[model samples]
Target chain A: MALLKIRNLTVRFATSTGSFTAVDGIDTEVDRGEVLAIVGESGSGKSVSMLAVMGLLPDTATITADEMSYDGHDLLHMTKAERRQLIGREITMIFQEPIASLNPSFTVGFQIEEVLRLNLGMSRRDAHARALELFRQVGIPLPEEKLTSYPHQMSGGQCQRVMIAMAIASKPRLLIADEPTTALDVTIQKQILDLLMDLQEEYGMALILITHDMGVVAETADRVVVQYQGKKMEEADVLSLFEAPKHPYTRALLSALPENATGDRLPTVSDFFGEAVR
Target chain B: MSVVLEGRNITQDYHIGGGLFGASKTVQALKGVSFSVEKGKTLAIVGESGSGKSTLARIIALIDAPSGGDLLIEGQPVNIALKRPDPVLRSKVQMVFQNPYGSLNPRQKIGSVLMEPLVINRPAIAAEERRALAEAMLVRVGLGPEHFNRFPHMFSGGQRQRIAIARALMLNPSLLVLDEPVSALDLSVQAQVLNLLADLQEEFGLTYVFVSHDLSVVRYIADDVMVISQGLAVEQGKREAVFANPTDAYTRQLFAATPVTDVEAIRARVAKRQAAREAAGAPR
Candidate 1:
C-alpha cells in the first residue's frame, strides 16, 4: 500500500497585488520504504507542496486538494490535536539550514530529550538515555559531549546530524527532508546522504527528499517528480527519468548542467522556448 | 603572456576566541599558497568550505592582507599588508561575490549603482558620458535599458547577479576575482550567466581568478586548476592534466563524490531492469 498519496494538490498565497497560485494541481505518491525526490528550481512549488502536506504553510496561504491521505488517514481534514499527535510521532521533517532550524538557547541534549518527553511520553531519565543512543545512531562523534553542546558550538555538518537524530527520535514512518544537504559541502553531503539511506533502510521509513540538484537525485532517489513554475513537468522512476525525459524543460535542465557541457555554448531553457516560438 | 597577478608563498592567520580573560589562538587559514594567472587566462581555485579558498581570494583581491608573502600585479610588486594598494593596482583588480542580493545596494536604482563606480574612478568623464557607459554595460550583461531605473529587489536572483557583474566590470579592471558567482543560480540561469562571463572575458581580454567548490564548473571555465585542502595547495596544473590524472587523494575523492549524469548507462540499466521485470510478470 502507498504510505502517502496526494491528488490535485493546489496551493495559493494571498499577495498584496493579488492572489498568487504557487502550486498547481499535482499528484504524487510515496510507497512504503521508497524514496521519492521532488526536484525543481526555486519558486517551482516543490517545497510548497510538501509544506502543505506537513501543515506547515502560513495562514495566508490557501491549500486544497481532491485527496490527500497518509496510511489510510485523511490528512486534509485532521484536527489540530490529532495533527500534533501525528506530526512528530509518525511523520517528521528536517529543513535545509540546520543552524537556523535548531534553537540556539537550548542544548542539543535538551532539545532531543524534549521531543522524546513530549511525543513519546518518556521520563527524563529515559529520554536522556535515548537521546544519547540516538546521537550515536546518527554517527555523531563523542555523543555524550555533543549532547551538552549548543547548536552554535557544533559545525554545520554536526548540527545537521543532530537535526537528523531529532527527526528520527520517534522512529517516524515517513520522513520529509527538504534540501537536507544543500547548505553542506559535497563530501559532507555524501556522508549525510549515506546516513539517511542507512536509517531509511533500518527503519523502513518512506522518505520525501526535496532538492534542485540532479546529481543528488541520481545518487539517492528511487523515483523523481520534476516541477517547473508551479507545474509538474514529469514523474517517473529515477532511471527512466534520467534516461528518457519527455518534457523539454527537464531535458534543458539536464543539458544545462556543466557535467555534460562540452560545447562552448550551453543549451538554456530560453533557447528551447525561443525555438518553440519560432 | 605576461603574469597579470602572482602570489608567492601567501599565508593568512586568523585569531579566534580572544576575550578579556582567555588567551587567543592563531589559526593558520592559508599556508604557503602560490599561483599565477597569465593575462587573458582563467585560474580556478577549488576547495570545500573552510579550506581557505576564500582567504586566498581576499588576499589576491586586496580586500584582506595576507600575513606573509608578496603580491605582484602586472610585473609591479606591492605591499598589501602595511599600506593601501596604489590607485592603479586597486583599479586593476575587482571582485564579484556570491550573494547577489547582499552585495548590491537595495536602496539605489540599478543605473546609479553602475554609474557610481565610474563617477568615483573616472571623474573627468562627464555625467552624460558616464550614463552612456553604464547603460552600455547594462546591455552587455544581457539586461535591458528598461531595467536601469528598477531597484535590486525588483529583479530575480539571476538578474541581480548580472547587475553585480556589470558593476564589477564598470571600472574595466584587467583582472576579475569571482568567488562562487554562479553557485546560487538555477541550472538554466547558471548556464546563461557562465556563457555571458565567457563572452565578456574574451571581449575584454580579462584575466580571471575563479574560486568555486563545484569542480565541474571549474573544468568548464578554468584553463588551470589548483586544489586546496586544509590550507595547502595539493595539486596544480593545466585543467586537462589535473582532471585526467589527479595525484592528490582529496582531489580523487572530490571527483568520485561528484555525481555526473550518464544517460546512456542509465538507459541500459533501465532496459535490463525492464527485461527482468517482464520475466517475473511484474506490473509496470
Candidate 2:
C-alpha cells in the first residue's frame, strides 16, 4: 500500500500584492520501502509540495486538492494538533541546507533529544542515550563528545549527518530527504548518499528523495517524477525515465549532464522549464 | 610575460601566537603554487573547500597579494602587496563571485551595479556614457537592455549570474576570475550559462581564470586544469591530458568520487565494492 498519496494537489502563497499558485495540480505517491524522487529546478515547487505534505507551510499559504492521504488518513481535514502529532513520528523531513535548517543555539544532542521526548514520550536521560546511539548510527565521530557541540562547530557534511540522525531518531515510517547532498563535495556527497541508502535498507522506511541531481536519482530511486514550472512534466519507473524520457524537459535534463565520457560541450535546452506540463 | 598572468613560487602563511605558552604557530594557505592562463584560454582551478582555490583567485585578481612570490601581469612585476593597485591594472582584471544572490546590493538596480564599476574606475566618463555602456554590457551578456531596470532579486539565479558576468565585463577586462560561476544554478541552466561563457570568451578574446569545485564542469569549459588540495597545486596540464591520464592519486580519487549517472554503471560499482569487502573479510 502507498504510504502517502496526493491527487491534484495545488498550493498558493498570499503575498502582499496577491495570491499566486506555487504548486500547480500535481499527483505523486510513495509506496512502502521504496524511494521516489521529484526532480526539478529551484522554484519548481517540489519542496513546497512536500512541505505541505508535512504540514509545515506558512500561515499565508492555501492548499486545495482533490485528495491527500497519509497512512490511510485524510490529511487535508486533519486538525492542527493531529497534524503536529503525526509530524516527526509517522513522517519526518530533512532539509537541503543543513546549517541553515539546524538550530544554531542548541547542541545537536539537545535538538535530537527534544524530538524524541516530545514525539516518543521518552525522558531526558533516555532521549540523550538514544541521541548518542543515533549519532553513532549516522557515522558521526565520537558520539559522546559531539553531544555537547553546537551545529556551527560541525562541518557541512557532519551537520547533514546530524540532521539525518535527528530525522530518523524517532523511527518515522516515511522520510523525506530534500536535496540532502546538493551542497556537499563529490566524495562527501557519495558517502552521505550511501549512508542514507544503507539506513533505508536497515529501517525499511519509505523515502521521498527530492533532488535536481539525476545521478542521485539513478542510484537511489525506484520511481521518479519530473516537474517543470510547478507542474508534473513526467512520471515513470527509474529505468524508463533514463532509457526513454517521454517529455522534452526530461530528455533535455539528461542531455545537459556532462558525464565522465561526454565530450567538451554540454548540449543545452533553451526555455526548457518555462512551459507548463501535466 | 608570454603568459598573461604568472605566479613564481607563490606562498602565503598566517601566524597564530602562543601555542604551548611560548611557541609561534603558523598556517600555510598556499604552498609554492604556480600556473597561468594565456590571453584567451580558460584555466580551471579545481578543489574542495579550503583547497586554496579562492585564495589563488584572489591573489591573481589583485584583491589580495601573495606573501612570498613574484606576480607578473603582462611581464611587469606587480608589487601589489607593497602598494595599492594601479588604476589601469585594476581595470584590466575582474572577478565574478560564487553567490549571485549575495554579490549584488539588494537596494540597487542592475544598471547601478554595472555603472558603479565604471564610475569608480573611470571617474572622467560622463553618467550618460556610463549608463549606455552598462546597457550594452547587458546585451553582451545575453541579457536585454530592458533588464537594466530590474533589481538583482527580480532575476532568476542563472540570470543574476549573467548580470554578474556582465558587470565583470563592463570594464573590458583582459582576464575574468570566475569563482564557481555556475555552481549555484540548476543543471540545464548551468549548461546554458557555461555555453554563454564559451561564446563570450571566443568573441571577446578574454582570458578566463575559472575556479570551481565540479570537475565535470571544469572539463566542459577549461583548456587546462590544475588540481588543488589543502592549499597546494597537485597537478597541472592540458584538460584532455589530465582527464585522460591522471597521474596523481588524489586526482584519481576525485575522478572516482564523481557519481556516474548510468544506473547499470552505479550498480556495478556498488557490487564491486561489496565483492571487495567480502573478499577481504573471507576467512579460511
Candidate 3:
C-alpha cells in the first residue's frame, strides 16, 4: 500500500487581484521506502502541491481534493488534534530556508527537544539526550555546543542539517524535502544529498524530493514527475523520463541543461513551446 | 590583445572579535591571488562558499580594496586603500550581483534604475538622452521599452536579471565583474541571460571576471578558469586545459562531486533495449 496518496488535488489562493489557482488538479502517490522527485521551475505549483499535502498553506488558500490519504487515513477530513498527532510524528517536512523556518528567540536545542517531547511524549531529560543523538546522527560537529547555539550562529549547511534532524526526530514514514540543497554550495549540496540518501536507506522511509535541478533529479530520484505551470507535464521512471520524455516541456527542460548543450545558443522551453507556456 | 584588468598578489584580511573583553584574530580571506583578463574574454573564478572567491570578486569590482595587492586597469595602477579611486577608473568596471531580486531597488522604476549610473557618472548628458539610452538598453537586454515604467517587483526573476544587466551596461564599463549572476534563475532563464551576456560581450568587446561554483556554467561561458581553495589560488589556466586536466586535488574533488545529468547514456540504453526487442521479433 502507498504511504501517501493524492488525487485531483487543487489549491487556489485569494490574492488582492483575484482568486489564483496555484495548483491545478494533480495526482500523486509515494510507496513505502521509495524516492519520488517533483521537478519544476518557479511558480510551477510543485511546492504548493506538497505544501497542500502537509497542510501548511496559508488560510487564504483553498484546498480541494477528491482523495488525500496517508496510511489509509483521510488527511483532508482529519480533525485538528488528529492532524497534530499524525503530522510531525508520521509525515514530516523540511523547508528550503532552514534558518527562517526555525525560531530566532529559542535555542536550537530547545526547539528540537520540544518536537521530541510533544510528538514522542518524552521527558525533558530524555528529549535532551535524544536531541544530542539526533544531532550526532546528522553529522553536526560539536553536537553538544551546537545545541546551545541559536540558528543565527550556524552556517547554511549546518542549519539545514539541524532542520533535517528535527524532521526525522520521530522517524517519520514520509519525508518531504522542498529544495533542500538549493540554497547551499555545490560541495555542501553533494554532502547533504548523500546524507539524505544514507538516512533514507537506513530508515527505509519514503522521500519526496521537490526540486528544480535536473542534475539533482538525475542523481537522487527513482521516479520523476515534471511539472509546468501548475500542471504535471510528464511522469515516468527516472530512466524513461530522461531517455524519452513524452512532453515537449520535459524534453526542452532536459535540453536546456548546460551539459546537454549542442551549440553556443541553448534551446529554452519557451523557444520550442512559445511564451504561452509561461 | 589589451589586458582590461589585472591583479598582482592580491590579499584580503579581516580582524574580528576584539572589542574589549576578547583578543582579536586576523583571518586571511584571500591570499596572493593574481590573474589578468583580456578584452572581449572571460575569466571564471570557481570555489566553494567561504573559499574567498567572492572576496576576490569584490576586490576586482572595486567594491572592496584588497589589504595588499597591485590592481591595474588598462595598464594604470590603482590602490583604493591608499586613495579614492578616480571616477573614470571606477566607471571602467561595474558589477552584477547574484540575486536579481535583491540587487534591484524595489521602489525605483526600471527607467531610473538604468539611468542612475549615467546620472551620477556622466552628468553632462541631458535628461532626455539618459532616458533614451536607458530605453535602448532595456530593449537590448531582451526586455521591451514598455517595461521601463514597471517596478522591480513587477518583473519576473529573469526579467529582473535582464534589468540588472541593463543597469550594469549603462556605465559602458570595459569590464563586468559578475558574481554568480545567473545562479538564481531557472535553467531556461539562465540560458537566456547567458546568451544575452555573450551577445553583449561580442557587440561591445567587454571583458568579464565571472565568479561561480557551478563548473558547468563556467565551462560554457569562460575562456579562462581559476580555482580557489582556502584563500589560495590552486589552479589557473585556459578553461579547456583546466577542465580537461585539473592538476589540483581540490579541483578534481569538486569535479567529481558535481552532478552531471547523463542524458546520452540513457538514450543509448533505450536504443539498446529497442534493438533487442526488434531482434526478438516483438510487434511495434
Q: Is the docking of candidate 2 incorrect, acceptable, medium or high quality?
A: acceptable
Worst 10 residues of 2 chain A by lDDT: A269-278
Clashing pairs in 2: B1-B75
Give the Å error, residue A159, model 3: 1.8
DockQ of every model listed?
0.59, 0.47, 0.43
How many residue pairs in model 2 have overlapping backbones? 1
Ranking by lDDT: 1, 3, 2
Query: Compared with the true structure, what per-residue lDDT tens digits does model 1 show for residues B169-271?
Result: 9999999999999999998999998999999999999999999999888998999999999899999999999999999999999988786678665556446
Query: Which candidate number has the best TM-score?
Result: 1
> What DockQ was computed for model 1?
0.59
Ranking by DockQ: 1, 2, 3
- Estimate, for each residue in A89-142, the C-alpha lDDT of model 2 and write its tens digit: 879999889999888999988888988898898999999889999999999999
Q: What is the lDDT of residue A250 in candidate 3?
A: 91
With candidate 3 superimposed using the best TM-score fit, by how many Å does residue A210's alpha carbon deviate from the native?
0.4
- Per-candidate TM-scores read 0.96, 0.92, 0.94
- Tens-place lDDT per residue, model 3, B130-179, is 99999999889999889989999998999999998899999899999999
Model 1's TM-score against the true structure: 0.96
